[model samples]
Target: MRILFEDSPDYEMVLGDYLERIPISWSRDESFGLLKTRLVAEPETTRDLAEKVMDNREKGGELAGSLLSAIAETSEGQDWMFESLTSGNVRKEASALVMLLNLISSITEPNLDHNLRLLKANAQSVSEDNTHLLLWCLEEACEKERDIFVPLLEEVLRTRGVPAASVYLSRPSLHRERPVSALVLAVEILEEKGLDNGEISLGLIGIYPKNREFVLERLKRWISKGKFPDSHHGMLVAHLKKHDTSPIIALIEELIDSGNRNALYVAANCLEELTQSISEWLGWCEKWESDSNKEPAVIRSLLEILSRLKTYEASGDRIRAIELVQKFASRSNIDYEDSTKHISLGKYSHEGCANTRQENRYTLKRP
Candidate 1:
C-alpha cells in the first residue's frame, strides 16, 4: 500500500508532504537500510528527507525510519556534516541537524550505530557552537545503544583526549537509569586518559541530581564492584541537601565503620541537618564517642548534625530530645568533652569549618 499525504493521517501526511520529491517509500521496517543506501548515493534529497523524518518523530510520537538510518549511515567522509552543522551559514540546516540528532536517539541500535559513527567522526571537528548538542546526542546514544556506542565514543575520547569527552560523560539523562556503570567507566577514562579533576567533577555532578536512593543504590553497587574510588567523596557531599537525613545518617555510620577520614568529614558535615535539640544531639554524641574512644570524625559529624539542628529541633520536647539522642548515641564510648564545650559555638560556624573544639563544645553545653 502506497502511503499518500491526503489519504494518510496528519503525522504521515506532514512527513510525506515534506519528502514528496524524494524517491523513497516508508516501510515499517528496513528504513535504516534505505537511509544507508541514500547516504551512500549522496542524493540532494537526503537532508530534506532526514528533516521530514525528524519532524514526524518530534511531533508524532514515533521517529521515522529513514531519519534514523541517515544517522546510522556511518561510512567514511561523513565527518564533514559535524563541522557543517556547527557553522553559522544556515541556522535552518543546523537546527535540522539538532532535530535529527534528538529524534533519532529514540531508535535503538544497531540502528543507532549510524549516528554514533557520525558523532564519533565529528567529535573532534572545530564546531564549538554545535559541540554541546552533539555531545548530548552521544550521551543519549550511550543510553539507548550502550553496547554499540560506548566503545566508539570511548575510542573517540581516547583520540581527542578525555578532556573533550567531559561534555558527553556528564549528560544527565544518560544517568537517569542505572548510572553506576557509566560513572565507573567515565572515571576510569578520565583517570587513565588524563582528564583534569574539574572535568571529572563536572561529569560526576551531572549525575548527582538524580534521586538520593538512586545515588545510594549506585554507591553500593560501585563498592561491591570495587571501582571509581577517587571520585565518590565530592559526588556524595555535593549531592547532600538539608533534607537528606536518613541517607546522611546511614552514610556517616558506614564511613565511621569503614574508617575513611574523608568520608567521615563528609558524613559529619551532612549531619549538620539534625541540630534540633541539645539532648538529642549530645545524646548521639555520647554514644558514638563512647564506642570509638576519641575518634574525632564521628564526634565531629554528630556535633555538626546536632549544631545545625539546634534551632530547628529546639522547640521539640527537651526530655524527648535527650532520650532520643541518648538512645541513638548509647552504643559507644560517649564523649561529651568537646560537644558540650562547643554547644554555644552556634550551629552556623561561618567559614571556620567543623572541628573537634566546636564538636566538643556542642556536646557539653547541651543541658
Candidate 2:
C-alpha cells in the first residue's frame, strides 16, 4: 500500500488484480483514514466539505486536500507530496493541483508558498480543465498579490485556449483593491476574445489610453447607456486619461437630472471630478431642499458631498455647502427637514483622503 506510483494518474485508475500482475498499493480504507485523520485548510469550511463529500462520494478535492495537508506537516512529507504533485504536472493532470486550489479559498490563500510550486507548474496548463484551475489560482494570486504573481498571471493568459478564461477575468470586481497589472493584462485578453463588458471596465482604470482606445470607447458607450456606473468608480474618468471630459460629464449630469436616487449617489461619489460643476451641485441641493418629495438618500448624498468639501481644499465650495446646509435646516415649510440637521450625516459615515490620479491616456469623444 505504501508504494508510490511514478505516474500519478495510475492511482486514480482501477486495477484488475486477477488478470494483471499483482502489486501492493494503499488500500482505499487506508487512504481515506489518512485524509480523515489529517487537518484541512479551513475547519468550518472543511466540516461543510466533509458533509458534501459524504453526500456525493465522487468528489476528490477535499479528500486530496486532506491527504496533502496531513502529509505536508513534516518536511519529508512535504517533499514527497511535492514530488507526487510534480509527477501529476508532468502528466498534465489537474487532479493534484486542483486539490491544492481546493485547499485554498475561492478568494485568497493565507500561505501562498504552500501552493507556489504547484502554481508555477500550472502556468502552462495542458487542457481546458487545467486552465480553469489556473484561473482559480490566478484569483488567489491576485488577492494576496506578490511580484511573482503578475508573470504567472501572464503565463496563464497565454495558455492555448485563453478565451475560456475571459468569462471570469472580465467580470466586475467588487474589491476596490485589485491587482492592476494582472487586471490590465486581463482586460487586453478579454478584448482579444471580443468580450465587450461594461462591468469590467474598472480593470481598465490605469491602462494607458494610447495603448488601447477601443476599451475606453466601449466604456464611454456603457457609461452613456448606464451599463457601467460612475458611482463606485469616482476616479475612472480621470484614470481614463481623457482630456475631453465634458461629454462624459454631460452624460453624468443627465443621470443626475433623471432623478434616480442611485444617480445622486454617483454625483456625490464623483464630486471631486465634478468640482467644475459646483454651481450645478448647489442648484440640486436647493431643488431637493425646496421639494417636499425628496428621498433621504438624495439629501444624504448632497450633504455627504458638501461635508466632504472640508477635505476638498476648496474654501469657497465648503462655505457655500455649509450655508446651504444651514438654509436647508432653517426652512420651516418642510416636515423634518430641520431634523435632518444631522439626517444626511446619519445615512453614511465615510472617511476622506486626497483624490489619487494615476496618469493613463485614452482619447474619448462622447457618442
Candidate 3:
C-alpha cells in the first residue's frame, strides 16, 4: 500500500521484502490470489496482504468485498488496518494503497469516520502520493457512507472552497436527471458549514422540493435575478405550488417577451406549467406562432411545448388548446393508407376536442 509506506520511512525495505516472498502476478486476479494465499499462511503479513487486495481490485476485478472479508476474518487484521494503510503510511508502496481502497470497496461498514480522522492525522506525515490517495479514499468513502461522512464532508467543504466545493457538490457518477439530488445533499453540507447562503440554497432547493423552506426563502431573495430555467421553475411549482406562482408567472411572461427565442421557449414551457388555465399561456403561444421571422427550430420547440400542455388534465384553456391542435393537425395533413399511421402532431384530435365539451362541464367546478 502506497499510503503505508508514505507513513513509514522504511516502506521501501518492507515492500522489497514482500515482493520477494509474495508470488503476486501483475494481473489483478493473480494479486488477489496472492493475498488470499497470504491470508491463509502468513497471518502476520496483514499489511502486505491488504496491499495486494487493494492492487488486485484496482486491476479491475470484483475482489474488494472478498478481500476485505478475508482480512476482517482474522483478529490480526486489526479493524484499523485499512485506515492505517489509507492514511498515507502506505504511500511509498503502491500495492498497499490499492489494497486499502479495495478492502473497503462498496461495503460502507460503520466506524469509517474514526478511521478517516486517523488517516487525516497521518496525512501530514505521508508523501504526496499517499496524501492524494487518502483524499480520494476519503471522497469515495464519503459518497457511500453519508451518515458520518456528511459532517466530515461539510468540514471539508467549508475548509476547501470553490473548485473543491463544486467538486464536492457534483457527483460525476450520477445521471443528468439525478445530479440535483447530489447538489441538494452538497448544499446541506455547505449550509452546515455556513459557507452556503440563501441564493445558493434556493437554487438547490428549487431543484429539490424536499429542501422546500430553504428553496422558497432563497428564491424569494433571488427572484429579481431573473426567470429560472424550466427545470428550476418546475421544481418551484412543486415546492411552493400555486402559492408563490404569481411572481414566477410574471417572470415567465417577461421571459416570453425577451426577444431571445430560447428564453421565450423556456418561458412558454413555464407558462404551460404555472397557471391552471391554458388560455393564459396561449397568448404567448399565439405570439410565437405568429412570428413569421421565427426560426423553424423555435417553432418546433414551441409546438412541442404546446403539445405538453395539451396533454395536462388540469389545463384551463380548452378553446385555445383545441385551436392549437387544429392548427398543427392541418399542417400534418398527409394522406395515409392506415388511419393509425396518420397520427397528427397538434394539441388534441378532432374527436378529443369535441369530447372536451363534456369534460369542461365538470372541470369548470374545480377550484
Candidate 4:
C-alpha cells in the first residue's frame, strides 16, 4: 500500500481498492498494523483510507474500529494526523480532520498528555477553517488530562481569538480548572483587539457571576479604554445585572459621561436594567440634572432612561422618575414640543398614565 501510494500512477484508485480488501483478506491486527504504517508514511492517503473505513463502519464493518485504534496509539500516526490538519491551505481538510479527531478521541488509552502538547504546538499555525478542528481535538484531549491541557487551552485561546477560544472557555465542565487563566487571556485579547466580536465578551460575562471581581474589573477597564464596542453594551449590562449592580451603575454613569454615543447607549440599557431600583434611577436623573454642562448626548441618553421609566408600574419611584425627567428637560431648556417628541412626557398625562401598567408596554423613541 505504501509503495502503491508513492510509486503507482493511479495510486488513489488502487489505494481505495486495497482499503476495501483489508477487512476481507487480512486479520484485524494485521490490518490495523498495515493501516498504521501507511498512515505514518502517507497521511493524506491514510486519511482517505480512514474515511473509507468510517463509511464502511456505518455499514457494520467491525475492522474500522481496530484500524482507528491502531492509528491513535502510535506516535507517528498522531503526528501524521496533526500534519494532515494543516496540509490543505487553499481549502481546509475539515472532513478528514474531523475523522482523525474522532479516531483520537475514541482510543480507550490515549496518550493525551503528549497529544495535547503536540496540539498546542500545532495551534500556533492555526487558520480560520482548521480552528474548530483544533479546538475539538484539544477539548477531547483535555477531557483526559486537565492539568496538562489547561495552559494549552489558554494558549489556544490567546492565539486563536474568541470564536475558537469561547468553545473551550464556555464549556461548563472546564470552568473550575483555572478559568481565571482563560478570563485573563480573554481580557488581554479584548485590550489588543477591542470587541470585534461578542463571543469573548459574552463568554466572559457568562462566567462573570462566578468570577466577579476579575471579570468586572476587566470589563470596566475595557469600557474605560473604549475597547468594548457599543453593540456589546446591552449584553454586558445584562450579565452585569447578575452581580452587584452598584459597580455596574457606576460604570454606566462613567460611560454616559464619556460622551461616546455607544457608551451612552449602553448606559441607557444599563439604567433600564437598573430601573427596578427606582432610587438608583432617581439618583442618576438628579445627578444629570444638577450638572450645568450636560452634553446633548448625555441628555439624550437620560431622556431614553426616563422614557424607559414610563413602562414601570405606577409607583412613587415611577412618579419621581417622571418628574425628574420633566425637571431635567426643563433645566436643559427642552420645550414641550421638543420634549414630547423625544422624551414623550405626554405619556405622563392622564391618558398616558392609564396605559403604563402593562409589561413592556412603553417603547421609548429617542430623537
| lDDT of each candidate versus the true structure | 0.47, 0.46, 0.45, 0.54
Encode model 4's per-residue lDDT on 190-224: one tens digit a residue.
65765545655656665576677776676566555
Which residue segments of model 2 deviate by more than 4 Å?
Answer: 1-59, 75-80, 83-95, 98-118, 138-145, 160-164, 167-177, 198-218, 224-367
What is the C-alpha lDDT profile of model 2 across 263-319, one tens digit per residue?
A: 444544343453356665555555556554443433565567665554523255455
> Alpha carbon lDDT of residue 159, candidate 3?
52
User: For every candidate structure, what is the RMSD over all alpha carbons to the true structure, in angstroms?
Assistant: 12.9, 16.0, 12.6, 11.0
Top candidate (lDDT): 4
Tens digit per residue, CA lDDT, model 1, 117-177:
6555555552444454545556666776678666655655555555456655554453445
Q: TM-scores, in order shown?
A: 0.43, 0.41, 0.41, 0.50
Q: Select the stronger candidate by lDDT from 2 and 4.
A: 4
Clashing pairs in 2: 1-25, 1-26, 209-361, 209-362
The best candidate by TM-score is 4
Q: Model 4: runs farther than 4 Å from truth?
A: 1-129, 156-178, 186-190, 193-196, 206-229, 252-266, 273-280, 286-302, 305-314, 325-367
Candidate 4 local Cα displacement, residue 66, angstroms: 16
